[model samples]
Target: MTDHTTTPPFDAADHLPDELIERIRARAARHDAENTFPHDDLDDLRSAGYLGILVPQDRGGAGLGVAEAAILQQRLAGASPATALAVNMHLVWTGVAKVLRDRGIDDLAFVQEGAAAGEVFAFGISEAGNDLVLFGSDTDAAPLPDGGYAFTGTKIFTSLSPAWTHLGLHGLDTSSPDGPRLVYAFVPRSAESEGTIEVRDDWDTLGMRATQSRTTVLSGAVAPADRVVRFVPPGPNPDPLVFGIFSVFEVLLASVYTGIARRALDVAVATAGARTSKKTGKTYAQDPDIRWHIADMALAYDALPPQIASLAADVDALADHGARWFSLLAGLKHRATATAKRVVDDAMLVAGGSSYFTRSELSRLYRDVLAGAFHPSDPESAHATLASAWLGPIES
Candidate 1:
């Protein structure tokens, strides 16, 4: 992996502020200990316009692209993976909203405005028995008498559900029982009508404790039909497949994992410098073996970004064929997620028993980075889909 550490003239946007970084460092420990969401750090992101970095300028946003967004998320994940995981959903939803706007669905202006203003938005996908399909939510929406729909089902792992103004829900339309009619809706979290949508504060996990990835149960929750922004046709939409939407998620998630790895490496290096081995009177870092582990950790962390960047560039070029792009995207996400898990796992090993203690930052990094493996675009499904594409019968 290339070492850009000595490279000068790096773009400032590619890095985060020292204060924010410090806050993330401090908050990572505090949030993990308290097992609560990182509200303070989120406020910093909002004030810095980082939350709306990907929103279009017309929608009162900075209009940044995926590359920039990925960079911001990577840096933030290094500080706190849970916060990064929780917040990145907003950008994903904003991107979806932008697509809706381009398709002439202007009724979602409120959501766009709220996103631009830094309002948190949770993604309601992933069900208990869905077998780790992130987008394969079990929630169902049935057409109502007033041209709207009544949504009812339980959505699990809804990151950022505890404090968010909006929710991007993906469900099937039961009214048309013949085939899968995927529907997307933007529900206002604060609305009285949405009271039926209960947020379950039961997101106790091995990592990403601050994500508030609790269960959200929607029981006959009526959402305006106008709020239905997009209805994805059953089977495959080439855009989601080709544009690498799933792959992008994987890549983005990998970025977060890399960040965690990076932080773990940093803490390890710092600790090694000061920590003396119990048997030998020498510093633990002085050992050649310890140095090699650090080198390997650095290599893994450095190798990930370029791979993701290359895939993203490919994705950007395939904007015309959404299906091909989405398929490729899925592949990318799969690779990155698995790679990230390995990198962080190695980081934890390198850190040794020090990482096991609550006082060590590596402890939290170890926990937070593991979540990437199980994030929406699971590695197993990605591989299965890729395998199907390779071995399945070719379309006539």
Candidate 2:
């Protein structure tokens, strides 16, 4: 419970006041029910300068580090998971830019400037069956005559699809003289990209509906030479761009789910205090069994935030974990998502059958929490990464 208001740089309370949070939370249900994106929420957040939290102060941003960003993200997620999740993509780019600038590599400085100017950046790395993640891409990156790259492929789960001003994506450049390479670039959503990008209105899902993370089809969408950020050999390698994306993405994602768990716990506590057990003529809060359930939920939920904070602090400090970074980050994400699921499940049970109703908060939380498993570091990928780190890769 660090008082973020007194922490320095910027105040979370000032940026996201209680009234603003309540307004965002108030609209979450309507957006979820209507399966629409939170345009109003986004407008409010933009006005608050939230989209630039990671940009440096000199760059007209809050100048917060990953640690503080994690805290603010948790607060936002507690109010509206969909809004927080959608905004995470924008934060990812700013965080990545911060990481690079801190490390003396200013490849993504434009990202910081763009964010500070209220330009939304969407992550466009995900492709169908592209298990290689950041190490590789299925999208085709053709070299243009002007040193730009024309990316032709489909990217799934493109968050902030409707309003993103710039789309950050990676693709495989097979014709490069240096052999196959992965080109990381950003395509601005402008008249130049009118016929090149197609956003499908196919974001209906089980939960987190306000995210509107839809499919993006890119047919020769161009990233001007100035916007092309990195050119690295495909396969696992030590590149700042890769590490920046992975680290910021994982920590922020863990923060979002951790927030969901916190909300579920709070709801359970309120429900338990209000609901009386007819069998014992006492409230569920007074029941030993119910107390234990809450204790378990708290125990599981309590461990996540500290873990995220510590790792995020290390990232901000540029502590080198070397090859261990991947395992540590993946493990953190895995634990957060898994623990959140358990906490939400326990909460539903504590809140009783009424929580099973379609419109119940717990019911929506249950569905929102499931999307955690399907994020970048799936349970399988996380376990494999951990196994490789602890047990070493299997003998080829």
By lDDT, who's the top model here? 2
How well is each residue in 1-396 modelled by candidate 2, as lDDT tens digits?
A: 223322445677877888889999999999999999999999999999999999999989988999999988888998999999999999999999999999999888888988989899999999999999899999999988888999999999998988999999999999977799999999989985623899999999999899999999999899999999999899988899999999999999999999899999999999999999999999999999999999999999889988998899999999999999999999999999999999999999999999999789889999999999999899999999999999999898
What range of 10 consecutive residues in model 1 has the weakest lDDT sum?
1-10
In TM-score terms, candidate 1 sits at: 0.87
Report the lDDT of model 2 for residue 134: 95
CA lDDT scores, all candidates in order:
0.69, 0.92
TM-score to native of every candidate shown:
0.87, 0.97
Cα lDDT, model 2, residue 6: 23
| Candidate 2 RMSD to the correct structure | 1.8
Residue lDDT tens for model 1, 1-396: 112442223453434676777677777878888889888878888888777766788878877656656666777887788888888777677655554455454555766788888787777767888873434547888877766777899888888877877777777885675766777776777567743888987877788898888888888777677777666654544434212335445556666766666666777777778878888889978978888877877776677677666665454443454334544666666665666666666666666776778777777776676677676556666666777667774468
For residue 15, give model 2's deviation from the true position in Å: 2.0
The Cα error of candidate 1 at residue 147, in Å, is: 3.1
Best by TM-score: 2
